[model samples]
Target chain A: MSTATFPEETRARLEVDAKEIIGRYPRQRSALLPLLHLVQSEEGFVSAKGIAFCADQLGLTTAEVTAVATFYTMYKRRPTGDFHVGVCTNTLCAVMGGDEIFAALKDHLGVGNDETTEDGRVSLEHIECNAACDFAPVVMVNWEFFDNQTPESAKRLVDDLRLGRDVAPTRGPDRLCTWKEASRVLAGFSDGRGAEGTQAGEPSLTGLRLARERGWTAPDPDRLPVGDDPEGGAA
Target chain B: MSTGTTLTPVLSDNWDRPESFTLEGYRATGGYGALRTALGMEPDALVDLVKASGLRGRGGAGFPTGMKWGFLPKDNPNPRYLVVNADESEPGTCKDIPLLLANPHALVEGVAIASYAIRSSQAFIYVRGEVLHVIRRVRHAVEEAYAAGLLGKDVLGSGFDLDVVVHAGAGAYICGEETALLDSLEGYRGQPRLKPPFPAVAGLYASPTVVNNVESIASVPSIVANGAEWFTAMGTEKSAGFGFFSLSGHVTRPGQYEAPLGITLRELLDMAGGIRAGHRLKFWTPGGSSTPIFTDEHLDTPLDFESVGAAGSMLGTRALQIFDETTCVVRAAGRWIQFYAHESCGKCTPCREGNFWMVQVLDRIEHGEGTEADLDKLLDICDNLLGRSFCALGDGAASPVMSSIKYFRQEYIDHVERGGCPFDHAKSTVWGGTA
Candidate 1:
């Protein structure tokens, strides 16, 4: 492993961002994760320069910073493609078609897990549980969910990404951006795309909808004993 | 019992409303009414109210919420902290992410109420990093709360000042554990710390901290708004109040079912339109993949902390991952074991080594290379890893394997005998397959 330094211009920009991130925490060491993300946003992955930058900003040794950076799965150690396509291959999703989707994508792209395509358009990996089980067989591009996915749909999604065609998530912003832009947002810098939309799926709101239909409410102090039944009426 | 059950949706009540994530919409829907009510009362009294309400922690461990809150030191010179474990990484647990995404203000409001009750000024919501959309929604909600004087200094005209930071965790399932989450928040490898100086005493910068789950904190506003007795009246004696029961996998309506803790799977299955179209329920997890798998016979087992435990599994996160007859039990268990193997932090020997060996055996079993001796080896390894590991992650790793072997040993035997899975792969298509 060789040590490298960030460019002066890059270092200057990161210093400002690093200061802002460190300001959020009581102890400056706590900002190490976000700072690594910040540097990763600039570079494709956690370069030798990124680790050095994080260490310099947090007043920690490179070894200390490297340990934290390597421990987390998000921070890439090497250059990745523009679109990081992660298909959920956990239990529910795999059983639903995540396995097939992953297999198909690997064949379609002619690249294995964590491998970038020849065009550098997409990098594919099998992610564990994006926490959208209801929308099983979810394929996430740049961390935006492409829910209820199949092998064909997922392949089409990556194809569109590679062709520079417009792509939208199942329930996200109007359009999808490159993986770098998503990383910047995850680094605590908003891309002004925050206000696009923030609606959950219909499945997510099922309980609330069912409750409303039945006129079921949490027991109110003032309206106690208003209903004949102690338990709210069955929906 | 009625075929259809009415659920008192506490955390998810405002999920369907438009702009529910916004402060204005939340206020319109009587959100933060609890924070206001809680602000008027003494913090200790609020704690007592939660204690009397019997609100247990919704983060899988059914520990009493108020008791956990009360564990914090009363007169610590260092600032006491309130850390919300929004790291909803349990495989089948899907409620918290949706809760934060749809109605983030509910969690924001809950954070406010909890911070005040615990007398903590600084709080952090350690959300999983993969869900960028959820993180954005929560950040936007926090910004809204701050602008409306709901957060920051002297909240809601009350003298209580609090600041909430929404921190995103780089993908690690162990971070879902409270201690590991604290370490992650402190910018270290997300590994579980030994107890004794639990988060309540020395956590996050060596101060007294109260780490509550996303759902647990989100449920606080409702508990405070509607008195303790009101909240207590819902669930069973041991487990009180409504909780988000995440129904996923083969269920017809795989969604968050916010019902009382004592509700049975039979009733939930009915509500979910029963295992897809016509498939019969096979083995299922009452909680996430971590809890012991249950079968059709246990459908009537109440999903409370006590009943589920009595039925031989913890009421873990209420992540009911339903599997139908078409699914392969061995294959599913193997997948779960692989997750545990992948997520093992490599801190403790049992978890680190045991899960690795289990996955190898499980893979062999699933791929038709396993023998009867592999079954004995699997059980032996699970026994070593069960309660002997450093944290619950080790124990969780062994659960699906142990439970599957317990209930569906024949399935394992059949795999060995047949040299392959018995279930047809075509029947378990991701979509366009008959139930």
Candidate 2:
């Protein structure tokens, strides 16, 4: 671990937040995950100083904090860029052009997977499924959905980020937040944009829309007859 | 033969509304009515109602939800806990995230109602960290519930105390496993704990805990508002009630289709405008990638617990990832193996090492650099992982690898003969024909 610690003012401010996090659980050790997020928000990645801060606050050793941090993919071992651009190269997304998009972004940004650009504007990684499979070939910049992406569109997305242009996600908040700002939200702090954007995307509403279009509604619960299969066909 | 009559929209009914995520928006649609109803009834009666409703867990394992809650020992003095598994990371399983994004209060209300049933005062929702917006929505909903006096001590002045905490999980697929989720919540490496006590006996600080899926818990409120018979009336005799059938990949209109269990994919595909333009279904997963893959022949298989099991695959999270003729099974299986191998917790040797070896073997075969013996070698690794790993992660890892070979052995042979994947990757992508 690095001998350096957070400067006095930063340490004092973080300790107050750490107190609130530790209080959420019955035991202080249970706060490690969120504390790690808090530190990542402070520094771009979980630095050695950050681990010491978490360990000191949570009453655990730095070794314990490092072990927990290393096990999870989200905790960055080193510095991260302003935007963490992840291409969903999982099976469904890969088959639907995620592989091509990842390759295109790598070429366009002059970076390999998990590597940040020279200007520190973007870090690229091939992420597992972020659970938006209906919008296939998805990309996430700092964990915001950039759904239904093409190779060209993904390239343009990174260029806009690197160039510091305004970028909006397909579904969530109207404007994308920095990676650090997003991590703070994950640490249980609100950015106040929770209800800012379209709550449901089109693909998320396919069944409901179709049912409404066909005027289909569930059968009245009170009208159902008794003596139906109670065990529900267990035999 | 399935028509609009087969559809039942309980959880997804209000998702289309722009204001569905807000407390006011949800209240306008009769939100929290079930929790109020549940508060007036005896807790045991609520449990009995769930048992009578035949509501099974929607998170891959189809264990009866009420049965799981009943597993809590009456003699245990430790504070019981309720954990909602919101870590929806299964490849192609996309329903819970959307549900929370559009309507998080349903889950919050379910948490309060189920907490009372299990007699637990505190509940925690472990959402995956990748979805920052979903975390915000859930957190905002909890804050709103507290402001409205719908949560916290003596909720709604009914003498039922409840507190909800929304916890975010760092990226780990194995944490979706209930035991691992508990471990992760307690600030440990998310490795699956061995069962004996299970989570019901000793979980989350060695306390008696009831863990349920997001969908399973969210279904509780509706079951409370409607009687058990209403739930049983919608679906088949066994797999009663409705679930989100998430259709992804090359389908013409891919999305979440909430229909009763046991609806045939053949009928759902008909509703989804069949496979894109001219393509026909080649193979698909009955659930997520973890379930064994199925081909066009199994399209008529009823998507329920027993029927899919009888057909040699589990109806996992109902994530029906469809693929058409242009996709290569070998490449698809390879990518899934890579996912499992990457996500393996390394707690069990069979899954950790077996997945590592399988990845190399599948890669060699996919690259057309291996002999035909590689197929048997791939199956051998799966055999070791299926029943031998510490948790279901290993079994899930072995699924697509074994099933793809079983259905498309000739495709593996084609990759071998052609010296690489035979299918052109360009034709299967969304932007394929346009450019």
Candidate 3:
């Protein structure tokens, strides 16, 4: 199969990026991972040509680039899609059922780890930690977040993205994060709940007092209520 | 005064207030005025101001920020890049993400100012991959700056162009290490490359680079708008400047506490509401969990780099992970070891294998399955990893491992002798079971 392609401009840019990556490493062979990332950004995989090009650009053998590319799971040595759904399966997320989300993606996308969709829309990569642990089972799609995801929400998101609908806001009915966890995360950083599994640390009066002292707080989010479920937290 | 009683000299003012995150609030409190001042001054003078302010890196190593900037070979004919390490994955470090969310402009302005000073056209904010919300907030702030003409070409008609790119990591703690962060920013597997090339001479794209912490860069605009002397007047002699301490674990306030350097934990706790009301402080990190642990006896020790170093530990990121009396030192150490094990990049043998082994020993001790010999063995393992590994992380991971044993050796022994954790039943209720 042909190596999955990216926007052509990305390919031209990867060359400069490739030289810089090679230039950073003392050993040319070490440039392989960076080269793979460059190609992935452009071609969506470290295709044979991509590997050969990187090897030639860095003055290393093709086998050299292939070695590091295959060694790390993040690099795809085959054709894949542009939009990658990264399911975080690290310990905390796993304990909170990140596995189910991974499974659901595999089932919904009809591809296992790293395999792309038939229409070349999305690929799945099982990752570790989406970082918002309190609202666990987070899947990062391209650069956007899909947190507290269940199979149903996962299906809806994939379907929406597949249909070319903007999944930007990432809220409303499909927003699976519980009211408490979602609000805490959206509310920037608060210690969430004292005894709950939420570990976002405590809030303070330094900023609270300064805002009040300077009269900078109230009119800012003028109409937004302080205790509202999910509004001012949106930046 | 930017000291106590609700004063914010620059970015962090009003962060405790409900709507302080809005652009309107940040604008009302003299936010972008620094950017205007920075735009007025020559980039060289801003660098001069920072150099005079004596600001140091807040990402553990505490390298002088101005000195680090000066390290870039100005006449070397290579494009310099400023990469902000927003990857706050250190075991007890929670300050940066909160800071970014609260005042993204602090970093955005810093990035803009640093990029101009360094003559870099592009800047990248490499955040912890896990902080999706924060990444979003920062990105939004960058967009806001660009819209306001604070970023991009000819900022406020200064005829200089800079682009700020907010990139997220795959959540590796190792990436916080300067060289590793560069590797990740360059879009690789996020491993630490060899140093001495040290991101100044040969960094991101084999050019001059500055890899600074979120707090370090965020502290810049103030030093720029306010004179260097104004910046210097707050803290002690060497470590002059305000700092953000991520006070977590058993602390009463348990959040990001921003204050000048040289403040004592007693003073900090007095500000933080004091040890969860009833509990007395037992163990804590003067910086993050990576630094050596400090006891209550050291409460009055100044938190500046010179003083902390005089007291035997570098004044690292100043992420104070406070543990009160009810918390078991062994369990806390065990939990920290688990984080190190999970975060160890596994590139070097000593950190990769050593952290895993320490976790196993610590796990056994935590679950009532350890022997007395294991305590010594734990110390032995940490000693090997301290300077043996490739990066500072191994050295950092070894710090807590060694200190927990140093100050609380008897605690480890007590856990082993009892065949279980001493505070399991007593303290589990405090955090409501997870401890």
Candidate 4:
């Protein structure tokens, strides 16, 4: 029944950004998700104030805004860590040592799933498939990839983060920022740093490289292969 | 081991080129040529070309792509829309993410052509939130396309104004469903809506819409560039044209193997260097984990939709997750069930409750705590979940449970008989301790 409010300066800044996001959609209510991201960009978690702010911008009740916020797993209800470390434990990744990485990190970092460390540095959790199965046993830091990771390497990666050492994603932009900065970028505000990272990995290009090497292609009408369908003239 | 199937690189042809994600790189490779040709033709004619090409949806369900576009009513005064489902969350399915990351312009160009064919000015690409790098690449591609006059008002001086919005979803698997995606786009919880007025009738602000998969849309430019006969020349009769079969797990070389529809896993395994080093293939999915598991006996089975279905599995997403002999089938199936349980969305009781119950039983069985009745109980729960649930998510949850038990019921019994998993836990575990 109670709702918190943001500070005046933060509220004014979000209002300007909210208007731009709302303008992107024909209906104001549709801006709810991005607006939640915008608020999370300002505050690490989706606070009560953040929910109230989204409701105000989208002209919806707090309950409706809260429903959408709680539905998605990405929006943090509590304060998240400076570095959100997620190990993929989906079927492929788990079989490829993701389960091991997850269990190791839990003991190594002294935090369970979705729990941030006491130092407020790293929050570790088991994420679903990130669609990067080519780089199996993937570990993501602040939503950037640390691909083909081993448990030892992942342990060191988190330690480096907590110690304030510079860490880099295996396949991401040259620069690595905190989780908050990534959230801001997701809020539709361009940071002028786009497409400046590694594009594709070796695993992604394996099939393409093999195809070019063998000179193989879709069956050409002029020069079909020897085992062409007997009934086929052309498809 | 070779089945002699040639690798056909349709969508991934230019992926190796540097800056393939850039507009210049795309244009250099004859990227937007199809858009230029398609813009000059009647939109209906372009639709007919796709229909004649026998292009089917590549986002798990093998529905006809052109027929999906034709479902949009023409008389509606309200603006129609095109939503590209880039939320590639199906386990072991990795093609769309890499495709967008390596060559986003292909999809941007596809979006333009698709929107033009559907007579819509606005479109959206809904990408999953976890892959920030992919989202950034897609956003940059859209910006570059707009700056090049390939998007926005009067594209390429063809008088077809279009706008593309790249939206990011915040970690929910159910949003990959087309209806749930539309609902997520409309700023609601990503839950499937009731049918009767499907997405074609009312979607994304109550306007007629066509939701196509990322691969399905990206395949369009090539189809338009080449003739329908050219597109149809590669794949089978019903399932025509090439698709990306993502081969992952214990393979010596795992990646997206682009081939024609009817290519068998045996040939693909040969291309991928065959199941790690010396280990033999134990079980695999023709698609993602949502489909039933296939053993080495079915290695020669053609992977087209019809053939895969005939062999008792839907070609859902063409994600071939290969597991080797060292893997425990019961443990693997348990992990997949945990995924379904974690992502059930809790909208329908069958999916939500059935997944939770299945996870409990599967975990107990894997940990040497289950009795024989648990096996029957697992199947009974699967029976309740399949077909009785709201969406395919329920059926998908039941697939690995039922199929794994069908093939590897002995392994489940062994876990109980031996009082533990026979396979070394360290081989699969990171810390090498017991579960």
Question: Which candidate should be chosen as best, given lDDT against the real structure?
Answer: 2
- Which residue segments of model 2 deviate by more than 4 Å? A225-235, B1-5, B433-435
Q: Every model's DockQ, to 2 decimals? A: 0.58, 0.82, 0.08, 0.63
- Each prediction's whole-model lDDT (CA): 0.86, 0.92, 0.66, 0.88
TM-score per candidate: 0.97, 0.98, 0.71, 0.97
Q: Write the per-residue lDDT of candidate 2 for residues B21-65, one digit (tens) a residue.
A: 999999988899999999999999999999988999999999999
Q: Give every prediction's interface RMSD.
A: 2.6, 1.1, 11.5, 2.2
Candidate that scores best on DockQ = 2
Error of 2 at B367 (Å): 0.8
Candidate 4 C-alpha lDDT tens digits along B214-287: 99999999889877777777778888899998988888898988998999999998898987765688999998
Which regions of candidate 1 are displaced past 4 Å? A225-235, B1-4
Residue range A53-145, candidate 1, lDDT tens digits: 888888899999889988989999989899999998888888878888999999999999999998998999999988899889899998998
TM-score of model number 4: 0.97
TM-scores computed on chain B for all candidates:
0.98, 0.98, 0.93, 0.97
Off by over 4 Å in 4: A219-235, B429-435
Question: CAPRI band of model 4?
Answer: medium
The model with the greater TM-score, 3 or 4, is: 4
Between the candidate structures 1 and 4, which one is better when assessed by DockQ? Answer: 4
